[model samples]
Target: MTRKRINVGLIGLGTVGGGVARLLLEQQRRLSDYLGAELTLARAADRDPALAQGLDLPAGVLVADGAAVVADPQVDIVVELIGGLEPARAFVLAAIAGGKHVATANKALLAHHGREIFLAARQKGVGVAFEASVGGGIPLIRSLREGLAANDISHCLGILNGTCNFILSKMTAEGAAYADVLAQAQQEGYAEADPTFDVAGTDTAHKLAIIAALVTGRQPELNDISTEGITKIAPLDIQLAGEFGFKVKLLAVLRKVGQAVELRVHPTLVPLGHPMASVDGPFNALFVEGDWVGEVLLYGRGAGRRPTASAVVGDVLDLARDVLCGCPGRVPPLGSAAEPEGPLALAPLDQTVCKYYFRFAAQDKPGVLAAISAVLAEHRISIEAVIQKGREEAGPVPIVMLTHEANEAAVQRALARINALPFIAEDTMFIRVAG
Candidate 1:
């Protein structure tokens, strides 16, 4: 029998969880009218039950245990907003066992244990919708799975972290230090008190794993990705990059090389004319290249209460449709193949080739440039441009340059050798140039 009224059980009443609850309630009539079923919030769970008070949920509808929501026979869809691996994992699995469709935004849980979760849903013949898991509310997953499904996706790169973008944009516009801008972001609630994940690139890497899965039909091991954070970037480097018509953005790159996929994340020097360069201040953008469709870029707010809530609710509606029709897996969870497909061989970073930007803090004295040049030349790395800022007083100065296409291994070796020189600071840094 078709469900005349869909009951939604929500777990987790935190930031995004709260947003989901609000959207579901506020948009109840529209949702019900659209689905042709009276959609209702049957129950909700959170560690702190008091948090649900402000939402004006139906009387006595709030619960303290997620298991209660899962056990409710009336619920046709269970939305898992409680993040993390253990209890969230357990809750989702229990819901699936109960034959309820699941919707989630837990990217880390999905990236780490997606195979198990996806397989479980496939076995149960239920849909696990996660459009909110990456690029919040951007509809990126749907676009990859449905809209652009016809073409072969050759490359995908995104500025997926809003905190990093906000900080970097402030640093670029204000000419302030990274630390100062990070503090400002924290003050403004753009960054967390401990902003390690966002700044360190782990957050973006997690999103990349999901994206690469959609692209290659398999998830790349997190270990296979080369992740470098924005904590080390200095104002001087940003200024130098701008001088050369480039902007620095923490970019997540996944492109096909032969049969293997190359997945990596780091701060990149994007040319000023590129769309990625102009994407600034807490906005996220993804640039995808398909064989037939050419290039497509998606730009959006990426993260926040309402934006994330919008995505989760969208997934909920999709699952609700499947439930009403008694036909699940209308779309695979990963949006590509039904199961995780490839060992999706990830190309070794050492074999990667790209242009690079180098900055060295060296004594303002003769022979420093020649010494650096000799080491780079030895490693077959050629410099394309140079900019040196030094004073007659002969203290430490900055020597910055851009290199032509060179092997990743060669650049690292050359940098290690160059930094080891007596006149050079061991803190010398290098950034990859995006094509």
Candidate 2:
């Protein structure tokens, strides 16, 4: 039996992009069998044409400008691997405008302008797939959009960033400081030359925003999502968190509180017993809570050339099946694009109640403890446990306290007052406790 061939126009033949091409060639038979259609890479676009010169290519397939690939009558679908806003956005919009089905792995581009792009694709009656945008090969977006579609998603919490997770895992296991672990991560190629986006929590926040929008049917305001980096985490704090039966991880959390949704990414202390606590190294894990499923955890390799390429190929195969059936526009861009009304209200950090771990360095003087307790009382914060380590070789003794669920604003105010005291040291560490 002769199989139908679906031509693919690829953009950005970089690391992941090149991998996608290679995977399509290497697994052509398998993918064809799964999709019940043969897939062919008909055209590709690369900023540097020289980069594509050495690759193995099927006859009649070659590098061309992005527009050439998108506008080609022979091209059936456009796969976007370009990783930015301006040209990528323009190229994607142009592809849809030209009536080409699109697939992308650009998270930043999607996070910021998904609504606009999805709307444009819907109007043109073309499908837009982004399975690789969120968690590499995790298939999290599909699980929420299709598998668990029956239930209303209440919340999603996860260790979404691989670089951040690797750094934190090293710090927790070896008791290394942030700079030292980050340096090691860079040397090992787990982190980028400039890892500000990953370390500063912006990267995870972007992923969180995409997931939140998919689950809630609305685009969340980026500025409203609270963000805190792991740069401030100290080795001593990691030790204390472990002693208290918790692991410190940079977590992206999105939950519904009444009609509002709270989205935040920060360094949180997860209970040792929790599923997320065991997710170490460069792995990613997401715990989703749905009305029917209760809680489900998805864990796997978050990022790598092969893992990400696997996801890209999955989308390509799905699109191939649609093309073969003569129903290319059957599925909507985002599965469903009815924009839900109302601004997504974010709960302030303080009002978002959670247990906390506070570490204080104070003078060995007598009444120091009393003063600290008094300040906490003034703010109506109650302590659940206290561990006071003896005087150190340095200026003050280390005093650690675990508090019951309390408003973060009051805790911050109390910490400010304690910082002003003559006995307390300038440095203190506070981490939120998550269960």
Candidate 3:
């Protein structure tokens, strides 16, 4: 009943990495019982050598460079927690070359260079587990890559970024301006110092790129995913959305239409009754639709030290079980090798139909409503409802319109025409309505 210990080497000793190490030590007995093998941290590599000073590390373990740790014959598995492109990519490839299984949480690395890395891992006959990459601890990756492998995935919509979600949730709940809420998020450590990646939709796009790859069986071209950030979302818009029975949230949506797959991330208005609408604060939710399963939603902590570490260690345990069973590479990196046939088509915004919410200021005068309605008619964009308010501050009156499913191009053209009219004040505020 005795089994050999699986040696694990860790790269990066920051928040997540530290959490992983602590969890591995704290849960070693249970993990070993489940895995039928002892898992040990044989070595670790961190940028700051002094990071190991206060920690209780095993004796004779090397605190060497990442390359050395990966190259070490003693380390059976390598955990890469150091995020970013260059060194992380190089180190991971080196680990694969050295015949070590990899467990990572780097979404950006996997999104940008996943094909190459997975191909290399396949050739090397090693497992590369990235359960922590997509929805942090949600296990959505496994659900998509394995649990639903039998179904044909038609769509994947997610509230993927926690920082952006936190900011938007605060803005909506507290009626605070974007800047004020973002500052609070930063102060609370929910956001970063330079929150551009989180707030500007880049982070969600990265996660979506990975999820798209898993669902479509093809690497999504990052540039092809049209991205719109949450920066332009105003408190007024949030208030209006609420009055109209909706909530604002940043959503990463991917859908298949015929041969095309439309991938986008933006601030969207979800009906109050929708599943994603209730996923407020620093939480993530994914809604996946398949031909057979219809619709399934996954919700959990999207990020954090322990939550992310839980995912990473879960992958490590899965890999250890495979190693124990002598079933290396039993599952393909993407759950399958067949490339998706045909060109990856994206539905043009104009052609892609959806309900829309439009709000803008207009001059308080007769025929103003008629002029706006005429422009909408000219573009074939139908208005489902209209709310007009008298001037509150002796200027332009506020006009709000909700449109039925319409082409985005027509909406833009109509809005442009309305903006040019002598009565319309400025560009109209438009938000996509989701159910």
Candidate 4:
């Protein structure tokens, strides 16, 4: 290792990529001072030349394309911040092939195609670091894989999506409708114009798949994760959840149940006193339960250019240290060199037994509540509580019920039967309860 400095070539000078550039430039002194090696910002590539105007990088530091950076023999690390499955994957694979350590913040690319990426890096004897993917600045991946390596993790419950959390929090605080709150979230830059990824739960599920794989050594099939978005969440549901001593949160649950793992993401009625219920806004929190550690909570600003860039820079520094030590891949992609024995069984959502909260808009006429209860009884679902006191006179009235622990399949069947009845004014809505 004749080189005393590690050169980092950066791809994408967009929001996050630009931040990474500033950090590498601004924190170069601190990083070199602390790590005892100069971490150099060698090349930055992006199609938009205008994006490089504000970066204040040297004349030749910015390039027109990523190939220049990936092909640069002087570059020791390639940082991919242009998120998506496409050219990013190509760039990363190319970097690994060139024996350059890689760092990225693309959760979707990792979730859908991580296994192949990890394998390629292993073969090339280079490292791939992605601490910025899951929780922006939470330091979650390294903490779990390294800090808590001694403990057998039992479950990980997380409020993982910032956009969804911001919308839900606004809806809860102002008692506003989902669409209105979503629009507000967009106006505030908390959500994208096309929020299907975050609000529809795909974003969170992708990150959870990474966390689950970190724990179980297998990325549970994304389809088997049973995703549900927050688009259906209403202010009325939020009020009802509050009345029921809970708060609605889009939660990602990954837990070990015996030999199987439960991977799920959905709008959950979290108990009011639970830490997750208090985590509102764009902030994120992960509650990890381990055998020896018992319980640990990681909470922080989970998104934004600065925070995410901090995570990316951390990965760059870590990889730089490895490079300086002449020991790349010191920490394997999934925290170990050995491959997982086999794919772990994923617990079916249908088989899950949990309490549920239901909201039914039924005709104000008589016999509706009894009919609904009868259908629930037919499915062997027993009600724990009900709120039928404020029945309106003119239109369909709201009927709320909290059920005792019931089979998910049974609940869905009962809901189907009840929704089909003529007296039911609209489709009944329900949220799984979590504590």
- The lDDT for every candidate, in the order shown, is 0.90, 0.85, 0.86, 0.91
What lDDT tens digits, residue by residue, belong to model 3 across residues 1-435?
A: 678889999998888888888888778898888788889988888878676665677786647688878888988999999999989999999999988899999999998898889889989999999999988889988999999998999877799999999999999889999999999999999999999999899999989988888887777777777888999988988988888889988999887878877888878889888888899899999998888988899999999998999999999988887888888777877888674453244666666678889887888888888888888989888888877767668788778888888887888888888888887777888888763
Q: What is candidate 1's lDDT per residue for 274-354, written digit by digit as tens?
A: 989999999998999999999999989899999999999988888888877878888887666555554557899988899
Off by over 4 Å in 4: 1-3, 342-344
Which residue segments of model 3 deviate by more than 4 Å? Answer: 62-64, 339-345
Clash counts for the predictions, in order: 0, 0, 1, 0
TM-score of each: 0.97, 0.95, 0.96, 0.97
Writing each residue's lDDT as its tens digit, candidate 2 over 309-357 gives 8998888777777777777767665555465564456777667778889
Better of 2 and 4 by TM-score: 4
Winning candidate number (lDDT): 4
TM-score, model 1 to reference:
0.97
Looking at candidate 4, what is the lDDT of residue 28? 86
TM-score of 2: 0.95
